[model samples]
Structure formats: structure tokens, C-alpha cells
Target chain A: MKHIIVYIEPKDASSLKRTSYEALTAARSIAGDAQITAFAVHGSEQALATAGNYGVQSVVVAKHDLLSTYSSTATAEALAQYAQSVSADTIILSGNASGKEISPRLSVKLKAGILPDCITLENDGGTVKAIRPVYAGKAHIAVQSISDHSIIALRPNVFTAKQEGSANASISSFTPNLEAKHAGVKVTSLVKNEGRLDVAEADIIVSGGRGMKGPEHFPIIEQLASTLNAAVGASRAVVDAGWRPHGEQVGQTGKTVSPSLYVACGISGAVQHLAGMSSSKFILAINKDKDAPIFKVADYGIVGDVFEVLPVLDAKLKAMLHS
Target chain B: MNILVCISQVPDTTAKIQVSGDGKSIEKTGIKFILNPYDEFAIEEGLRLRERFGGTVIALTVGSETSKEILRTALAMGVDKAGIVKTDDILDSYNVAENIAGYAKSISPDLVIFGRQSIDFDSSGMAPMVAEMLDLPSISVVSSWNIENNVITAERDIEGGKEVLTCSIPCVISAQKGLNDPRYPKLPDIMKAKSKPIEEIASCHGSALVSLTSMVLPSSKRVGMIVGDSEAEIASVVTALHEQAKVI
Candidate 1:
């Protein structure tokens, strides 16, 4: 791929999100001496300067009054305009919520094929091929783009964003041709979930299910998760029963996650649940029933009452981690 | 409102999936296809919008003849009409979005709705793609929303939080799971829906933008260490996670 443009999602005005660096690293790996540029609609000079550590030498910030408030269509128009002006053949972005919204519009605007939520990307014989999960991670398929221009959205937490070398990122500005019609949707505000981590982007997850019995007993799960600095996850039953928010649900209908470590607490592994997290690097299932289905897919299993085992486990982990 | 609700039929989540002989598609035989679970929220939202403001809610899909079954489900759920862009050929996301946008262009609906993503592909790209194609604003994964004076205010789920957004009418939206509880069609409505006519249009899909080259099941080999939860066993588990798994 030549003339690659990586869309940078800002964490705030001062810094870029971790996923942006992941996309930047992904682009650099497959770039093969191609010119790599970082593109963002928001970010301060310092935030844009950090792209140099990820192997980008140039940055293009789209400047427009409408861009101060986030609109997927307008932001996409800005990126598309810049990509077209530079004749960029490849675009890369983080496969997060914002990227998911913008990539499709960029595809339509640029007439480019897109590979969404890709876990692996390889450039084989001048053609870029990608591997992405389908059927809720039950299976994976290898896909590729045939169109002249292409977009790739890398899944969060999968690609390692490491600084290989440093370069001075040259900052430039691009003004997109936007009109009143372009500002169709405006993001009024963001209601943060406070300190809770989202399962979609967590490296470690401690998940509870029907075995937890009720909403009142989730502190044990939460405490253990806090010890590990992991996100708290739940099965569909708990979410449907209103014990937890839909954001933490992990299953076929809910979010699919592949964390470095997954601890399934009191969860009887349903096929649908397995479909979501079987791809985790290590699985630890804790249940009282020795014959629970969760054991079938777990790397380690503690077959005992969670009420008894969790306290001891939590205390032990606290000691070990804190020490 | 003139709402357009888009839906798709997918293999039941409980069903096992196998790759087709072509290595590029899934085997359909012996699989029970049902209305995509997320689309139920979309259809319900459309019906509710129509109920709130006097309007027509038309359920639309792009698939082969068999896909009309999902339209029947939408009809039973109380949509005013149903239509399908008939095609048996396997079309990519771009092709499907093109067909949906083409049909949407002909009949200018005040609002278009879709499931956040199809379970089979799980791309979550259609609503935004079609919105761009039609040059309209769009919101996806909307969990809650309200309409006043033809302006829509929606709250959508994002990582670690939610975003509140606003757009005028003549927009597009995809329903998230918690948008509303979908209604189950009664037996009488199901029987009546059987007789409802579904308009069939020839597919005008463009060339595929992406192509699936291969498919394979992920190979996962676990350690499969089972231990009791005694104090010693608990300590051993912690040791394993630390020294052996090296993940602690």
C-alpha cells in the first residue's frame, strides 16, 4: 500500500487515544517504505507531535468551524477531501465506535473497499489481506480489497502499539469544502461512565454470570476485577435480568471480546458465551459445579462455590499483586 | 414519518456454523434462519415512532426470496408494508448498501432505520454507508432517543461511556439492544401477515468492494487444568497464573 493515511482519534484536545497509535503502528508495519501520514480533526500541537514516535513523519489536521463539534459525516468529508487531494490509496483507523462510523462513509466517498474490525493484516505480493472474526468469533475469515483505494479498521487491544523510531511530524492544515448540509448530525456531549473500563478494549476481564445469583453479590466480582485492573463483564442473562448494564454484556448478541486473560465467574459456558470469549489467550473458569460447561473451554478451573473460593482468591491475588 | 426499517435474516445464534465448500461462504443447509436479533429493536423503534407521530413504517430487506420470511416477521410486528430487493447472489457490504440506498433514493423517506449490525457479518457498516450514499445524517447504536419538532436527540453507546447526538428528520439510525423491548407477534397477527403482499424488486447491486478469500475455524488449545478450591488449591491457582501463565 502506498500513500497511507491513518486517521487519528483524539483522546482529548491534548492527546490521541491509544487506538490511534495502534492504527499508526499497523499502517507502518505494512507500509513498505510508503509515505505514512497522520490525519486528525482534533488534537493539540503536542498531541499531534506524538505521532512521530509511531513512525509517522507528517500530520494533517482538518480545520473547520463545524469540526469543533463532532459530526461523523462532516469529519468523514474532511478526511475524504484530504485523502483525495493527496491521492491516498490506503486509509487505516481504529475499529472503535467513531472509526466504525467514519470508515463506511469514507468508503462510499472514496469508492474504496473496507475491512472492518480486522485482527491481522498482511501484505502479500502487493495485495493487502486481512483476517477478521465473524459469527461472534466462532470462526475467522481472510478477506481482501480489490478496489484501487482501501480502508482498514484495526480491532482494539489486538495490535501492539509500540514506538520503533522517532521522526519530527510536520503539521499541516487542510480546509474541507463543507456546507450547511454537511453539518447534519452533531454530538452534543459525552456522558462518561466514570472509572469503569469497557470490556471491548480491556486487556483483562473478570466476568460474572447466573452463578453470581443476583446483582447484590457483584462486589466480589468487582473487587477481584479491581485487583487485576480488569474490566467487568457479564453474561446475557444478567444483563437481561437488569443486574448489569448492556455495556458489559458479552455473548453472541452482545459485544465480542478477546482479552489477554478472561476469568469467567460462576458462568456455565453456553455456546453463545463461548462464541464471544473463547479466543481469549487464557481462560480461568470458577464454578461450584464440576461438570459445568465453562470448564470445557477454560485453561484453568476451580470447581467450588464462588462464595467461598472468590474471597480466598481475591485475598491471595491482592497479596501477590500488591507485594 | 415515512419510516423505512431495514432487516436481514441470519442463522440462529445457537446454530453451529460451517464453511461452505467454496471456502468463501457459510453452509446454509441444516441451519435455521431467523430475523437478526438486533433488527427486532429496529423494527420496534420504527413502529413506536409511527405510533407517536402519524406515519407509515415500511420494512425493507435485501436478500433472496427466502429472506421475505423476515419481512413477514416485521409485518406481524405491525409494519404497514414490506419490500425485498430480491437477489440470490452473494453480495458484499458495498453491494448491499448500494441496493438499499438506491431503493431509498426512489422513495424519499423521512427517516431510515436499521439494526446496529447484522449478526452474520457483524460489520455494523450498512446504516452509515447508506446514509453517506444518500447524503443524509445518520446515528448508529442508538440506545435511547426522542423526537420533537422533527428533530431527533439520541444517546448512543461508545467505549466507556455514551454520546448524546442530535439531527433533523430525514436521517438514518441503527438501533442498539437496549433501545426498547421488541414485541412478540401474536398468532393471529402471524396468520394475517402470511397473506400480506411483499413488494419484490430486482436487485441493482454494484460490484463487490471486498472479497472473502478463505475461511477457517480458529485453533485454540487450552491447558485444561482443573483443581479444587481448597486453600492450597487456591494458592496453587494463583501461583500458576503468576509463574506459569505469566499473566498475573
Candidate 2:
């Protein structure tokens, strides 16, 4: 029996929308006979209760004054304390902003190994192996954690949460003697990106590149996205040119998203760009060049003009949805 | 003020990439190592901050002694001193950040800086992890920063836009591109860099915490069918997109 824990980020729950359940799934899968403890920092009880529906046996709250703010060290220290208390063999964290920040710090404190941005995880006879992207998304690396303590940052959108029953998971409190001087960084304000779907949470995304010509040409992608109720994205080239916001950029430098379906428009698949979006469940590429590398990874590819094609597809989609 | 900038050695982006026979590691043939593009931004910002307020800027790198080349480059760019945490080990970013934070604390700098992410292993988690270890306030991917009365103001990239933040001094910041174009090293500065002090502290602990078990390259692509050409080809492509791909 192995015990697993999830370091939850409450603020990102709504933004990420589904990582709690996914984290639970990964935790349960890894923990055979052992219990699963879901830890949420300075968040409400409702958030912890929500964990029960996802099969978490208990919830641990690191209730403290400073927990309300984002303290990488404090959060890491707190999680490390909880892991020690529960004797967790593995710690599961959602591959979101907060988890990404905390997992490594916790790994350092515990002297544990960390598998980052893993698309999948499995345990074989007390050995936890995680699959991650390597070679800039051109390859997959399967890594095994040999340390007594292990951390896995599950790639978002790979696992859909399945609910069993709702119950009050046994809740406990945890507090780390956080040095006041050490709780330094704080998330003063989160300038939430509005009007577009979060790539991390989106089921489908449509991304464009420099081939769109300019920022003005983005209306076509927006229209297509609007018709399909999909998220919008951009290539590094477009973001580099300021044609799109940096958040919209999908590449190694930008956000790494794993959507159910990804439509790449007018973008040649550069390796750096593909590393971020290669985990998409279904990839469709549209470009004018027949030899673009994206077409190799794309399950479906179209070499033509995005400008004329998007509107027609939008209209047909609207007609089909209306019909 | 004491500022430390952590630099990584990476192959030039424009260079061709060749993988090993098994596709596990990058083939270093013909590739030249340079200071990470983002860390260069960190070095420039450190120099800028030092010039604005008389301070010491020390550049550090975690690699073999040859990695000191980038430190030398930073020193030539007017950084006061440089150091190399010589290790041929590829520690996970966590271990790397831990080693860096420990070394930084040993020096007791007023501020620490690095790029948002390194090119080789772009976890983008190094700065935050270091901040976490030291419990230092941090703002990442900052385009602008200001220092006044022991407080630091900065900005970071958010989902849709950017967030502006202010924290106390002795903070950490990960540099974002366009923060400042790194300045060219002058001959006088290059000559002076030869005389700068440097230290190599070999920490025999940590590293090799995580081992890459297996790896595979991306599957080869199929020769996709080209429907037509130009704007008119878009209609056929869209039709194919709906009927064949069903993406619509």
C-alpha cells in the first residue's frame, strides 16, 4: 500500500476547473491500498469537500495566516511537513502555475525526485514511472523515481475526473513554522486573462501564426473559434511580433497546453512551438506550405489559406449546430 | 547592493540539432555553447541595477568549469565578479535551484535574478524555486522594475495580460525578453574582466536525483495531400477539413 498526496491550488481551481479531480485520479492510481490525502492551502472548506467527490479519503488544510498568499517556500515547507506527517510515498500536483512553482521547491526540501509536466503516470511494484516530453516535444521520456519521496506534476486536460460519491472527507489542519522573514513573495494581483478560454482547461483550441499576416487577420480565427466555442491561441512568431498577446502564444517559451483537439492555422510547426502543444489529444494543422513539420504530427492537415477557409467553416458549423 | 545572476550554457538557437544514435541526448557536434538567451537579459538587468545604484554584480553558472565562459562574458559585460559551481551532473531543476539558492545565500546578495526559463530545460521554475527556498519575494518575466527605499516593483506575465507587483528589496526576478537589450562588452571592460575575482565551490552533494529512464523521438509524418493553391484553395481545404478531418 502506498500513500499519495495532492498539493491543491485553490485560486486556480476555478481557472483550471478540473485539476483537483485529475490529481485525485493520479493519486488513487498510484496509491493501491494506501490512503489519498488532498491538501489545499488557505482555501475554503467547500473546496476541500469538493475533493471527496473525486475519491480523496481525507483532506489536510495547512491553515495559517500566510497561506492566503502565494509563498513558494512556505507552501513547499508546508507540503513537506504534511508529507512527513502522513508518510506519503508520492505527492501529486496539477501541472498548473502554482503547482509547478511549489512541486520543485518541495522536491528540493525533501530531497525527492520530481517528474515535471508528465502526460501520464503509473506505478509498478513500488516504482513510479512518469512519461514526459523531451527533445522539445519531439520525443517522450519515461522516467522512474527511485527516491523514497516522489513528486509528479500531471499535465492538465489528460485526465477527466470521474465522480463516485460525495462525503465529508476527514479534514485535518497543518501549520509550518514559517519564518515571517521567509514568507516573502506575494501574489498582489492576478490580472486574469479574459475573453478567451484558458488553454490549460480548454477542450479545444485554435492557434494561428505569422502566416495570418497581421493582428487584423485574427478575426478569422476568432470567428472560427466562436463558431466552435473553442479557445484561441497563437504561435511564438505572432506573439513575438506583438500580433497576439504573450499568453496566447503556444510554444516552449509560452504556455504548454494539452487540449482535446488543437487546430494550428498558418503556422509551420517549429520544434520549440510543438513542445508546448504536442500533447493535444487530436492535432489538426493548416498551412500554405505542404512541407511544414506540423503536418507530420497533425492527424489532419490542410495546406491552403486560413482567411477564406475559416469563415466558410464557421458558417457551416453554425448551420450544423442550429440544425 | 549585491546582485547574483545565474546563467546557463545552451547551444545557439540557430544551430542545427542532431540527436544521439538512440535519440536520448542532443548531439553536441558542431554546436557552440553560449550564455542562455534569457539569462543574458538577467545579466543586463543586473548590470543596469548595479550602475544605477553602486553595487556588486556576480555572475554564477552550474556546470563544468568551461561554463565559466558565460560568466566571463557577463564579467566582460561589466559584472563585477563571476563564479562557477563546477559539476558535470545534470540535476533536476529542483536540485539545480537548491544548489543555486544555497550558493546565493552563502554570498548574501540584496537581490537575485535569472531568466524566466532556460533554453535547454525551460521549466521556468528556477527563479520561483530559489525564491521559495530563500523565502525571498519574487516577480517573474518582469518587463519593468524599480527600486526605492528597500522595496522592489516589478511585473510578470499572466494569462491574458501582465500583472504589476511591488515587493521588498532582497527579492528575486526572472528576466523577460524586451526587458532590455543586452549591451555589447567594451574592450576596456573585457580587459578588466581578466582581473576580476572568481571562486569555484565544488558541492559534492545532490545532483543525479532524477534519471531519464527512456526516450523516443516524434513519429514520422505522412506525406499529406495538398488539395489546391492560393485563396481559392481554402474552400476545398475547408470542405476537406469538414468532410475528412471533421474538425469543423
Candidate 3:
């Protein structure tokens, strides 16, 4: 029996993210006998076409007024309906931003158990055992739910993207049974940083800590990230200092990122911060303090000033790209 | 208009947590419970809104009797009422949400507010579930809110930036930090909190959506190599990256 993956569509307002495609490839690993269904809880024809490229067996859009605005409650209720409709034994979700907000609720709606922040998933007999980091990033624990319909939220970038084949699944719309009170809390506005990649969805990222001094020095780190086409991240200290927004922070209290390449310019790698990004495929550390905890997890270490090292590395990368 | 604030009584971020004798959970000895930092922002916003527009602020928590102590903390900060859905054992996030939704259904407040996610479990799902169970609109990671008659203006932090939203009232909004600095409880307010009305509810014992079979502490650090201070020592250190550390 193959596992089914559900790429929960947020209320089709925001642009589609790369994590959606990455999640489809992850579902392929488990989608064999049981076909995978990529669901759009509140998407339109344009959103459906946008989701087509992600290699999934089918894209089912639950067209409903209840989904008019994004609500974890509405999404959970809608996805629960789909899970039962298809008799899906295993449901895979992205452990990034949206998944963290809704997976627990969806599991409740379906009376299922979820293994969250799972970095790997495999079939065990009829059960799905998942590997996830626990007690921060110091250890990895394997969880096997002794229950029916296990929900697993995979960490971003943990599974390699394999979209060679297009599943090109059928598209359908669903209307949810929305209640009036459910529409009570409405969003009035939005604010966001421009050009930078979604920290959780980035393939490469460069983060700075309070060691970066202030917001004035963040531009250097941004320059390095721009050179690599990577994302920008910050430590709690920097965020608390008002040098960066809380969204850019990486820690137990911040956004967790698992990029292919992670460059820590001034971060000391506090346990909380490491819990967010320690799963990266490769990590590079450049700090003035050699004893920074980040070096413990780094694949490459550079002990020097970030101001001096960043420009040099940026130049080297530019030269390599030009040459 | 009335506003309900769902608050979680969590261990202070600075609290020292250690494994118990059996190594199964955080040691409970001498632990103090406080309002979840994120929820404090929610409660504070509720109070501020009430002050400006004239509404009641009600604080609620689902936890043991001892956890209710945090309610006084909220009351001392000028909240109108406090409620606790009594429960013991590690109630999973889903069950907690079910209990909260039940509470919301009975009270039927015009507006509900919650922290985007709690510090524990890190699931951040309860308020949304309650809103859904009641069939209300909810916005997560909400950093700002402005109310105008029947409509509410909210700001949600999305990937790369924020999206300004305009939704009607009677909705759920999860307060993100930085939206406002939680007001400190003054001496007079703290004294008056003892007189504030508190209601205790029976545990709903609803089935939780997720469960933690077990929890264990992380492994200890293997070894840490320290570097010397000085410009001359830099070259030898670079050598260790390729040699001893095998990281270059």
C-alpha cells in the first residue's frame, strides 16, 4: 500500500511556495498502490494550474465559502473530510509554517496521531514510522504510532526534490460547510520583507546573530545571501534587539529552516536556534569566537571577522560564477 | 462587544527545566507557572481594546488548579474575569483545543484572541480549532489589529512579508509578539485582582488529536576544543580545521 500526501493549500491568496512542490516529491516516495492527492482547500483555476507542476497524482480543490479566508479550523475540517473520503492511511504535510499551525488540529478532526517535524518517513508493515528531532536538535527520535491514519509533517529540505515525472492529477473544487461564527476573526492587512526567499523554503540561507552589531550591518549578510541566491535569517538576540523582524528569526521560538546549504555568519548557534536549522544538509560557520556552539555542527569552519570574511567569500563566489 | 482571551499557563522562558528522576519529563520541583508570553500580548491587547472601545476582557486557561494562579496575574493586569478548564496529565494540543472550543461555544464572545502558538507542544492549533468548531474566521501569526465598526483590520506575517487583511468582527486573531508590549501589573491592580471574579469549569476530557508516547532528553556534548586568543595563532588554527577537526 502506498502512502498519500496532502499539500494543504492556504486560502489561495498568497503566492504558491516551493515547499509545495518539494512536498509532492516526498509523497512520491510513499505513493505506490495508494495514489497521492494534493488538495487545495481554497484555490481557484489559476491556483490549480499553478499547483500542477508539482508531481502529484491529483489536485483536488475543495471549493467552499468556508475557505474564503485561511483558518486552521476550516482547513482541518476540510482535509479531514478528504482523508476519510479517500481512506488515506498516511497523510504527509510540510512541517514548515502552515503545517505547524494546522497538522495538530487536522489530526484531532480525524482522530489520528501526528509525528511532527519528521525528517524521514518509511513504511513499517502497515504503520508509518517517522524520524524527528527531539529536545531541541541534540537528538533524533523515531516514532511509530500504534494507531490508524498516522499524520506526518516532513521538515522542509530534508527530502531531496525528485520531480522527474509529472503526476498531473485531476483538479476538482470543494465547498466547505462554513459557520457564521467561523468567519468572525478577519484579517485587515499584511506586511512583509521584499525579495528574500521564504526562510523555511530556501535551499540556501545565511543567518546573523547579535554579533552582527545592529540592523546597519545586516546588509553585509544580505549581500552574501544575494550572491548565493539564498535567504536571510537572524538569531533571537538580533530579533529582540529590533535589528530584524521576528519572522526572520531561527530558533525554537522562531521559524525552523532546513536548507541544503546554511552559512552562519555571526550566529553562536544557541540550542534554541539550532533546533530550528540543525537539520540542514551542510552548514558553514564564520564567527570571531571559535568556541561558538555552531562549530559543533558545521561542515566548514572559519574563525575570523564576518565583515572581512563575507566580502572575501562574496568576491570568491562572484569570481567563480563569472569565470 | 466582548472579547475572550485564551491564555496558556506555561513555565516562564527563563525557568530552569531539568529531567525528573525517571527522566521522562521536565522536573516539576519548585516550578512556577506564568502566562505564556505570547498570550500575555493577547490579553494586553484585549484590555487595550476594551479601554478604547468599551468592552469586557475575559481570560481563560485549561490546566490544573495550580495553573489558575496565573489568572490572578492577568486579573491584576486589569482583565475583567478569569476562567479555568480544569485538567490534569499532559492533555495533548488537540484535546485542549476541543475543551477550549466547548468553552467558547457556551460563552459565545463576540471576539476571540489567542497567541499564534504556545511555547509548549509548539502546535499553535487550539484557537483555530475552536474558531472552526464554532465556524468563525481566524488569522494566525497576527501582528497588528485595528477595529472599525463591524469590520476588523488585521496584519498577518506571511512568508517574505506581511499581507494586510480586512475581515469582519466575531473572528479569531492569534496575537504575534511585537504587536504590543504586554503591560506590567501595577501594585494597585495586583491588589484588586484578588477581588476579580474567577470561574472554574469541569474538565471536558475530550479526545486529543495528537499524543506524545514518550519524551527523552538530548544527548550530552561529546567534546569541545577551545582556540587561543591572538593574531599569530590564526594560521595554526586553520591547520586544525583540515587536520584535527576535518572541517575546512
Q: Which candidate is the best by lDDT?
A: 1
**Better candidate number, 1 or 2, judged by TM-score:** 1
Q: Which is the better candidate, 1 or 2, if ranked by lDDT?
A: 1
Q: Rank the candidates by TM-score, best first.
A: 1, 2, 3
Q: At residue B184, what lDDT does model 3 achieve? A: 92
Off by over 4 Å in 2: A11-16, A165-170, B14-24, B132-137, B159-166, B184-199, B220-248
Q: Write the per-residue lDDT of candidate 1 for residues B1-248, one digit (tens) a residue.
A: 89999999999987788988988788889999999999999999999988988789999999998999999999999999999999989898999999999999888999999999988888899999999999999998999999999999999978878899999989999998888999999999999999999999889976899989999877768989999989999888889999999989
Task: Tell me how many residue pairs clash in candidate 2.
Answer: 0
DockQ for each model: 0.78, 0.41, 0.24
Which model is ahead, 1 or 3, in terms of lDDT? 1
Q: What is the interface RMSD of each candidate, in Å?
A: 1.5, 3.4, 5.0
In terms of DockQ, the best-performing candidate is: 1
What TM-scores do the predictions have?
Answer: 0.97, 0.88, 0.82
Q: What CAPRI grade goes to candidate 2?
A: acceptable
Model 3: CAPRI class = acceptable
lDDT per residue (tens digit) for residues A258-285 in model 3: 7777788889887778877887766777
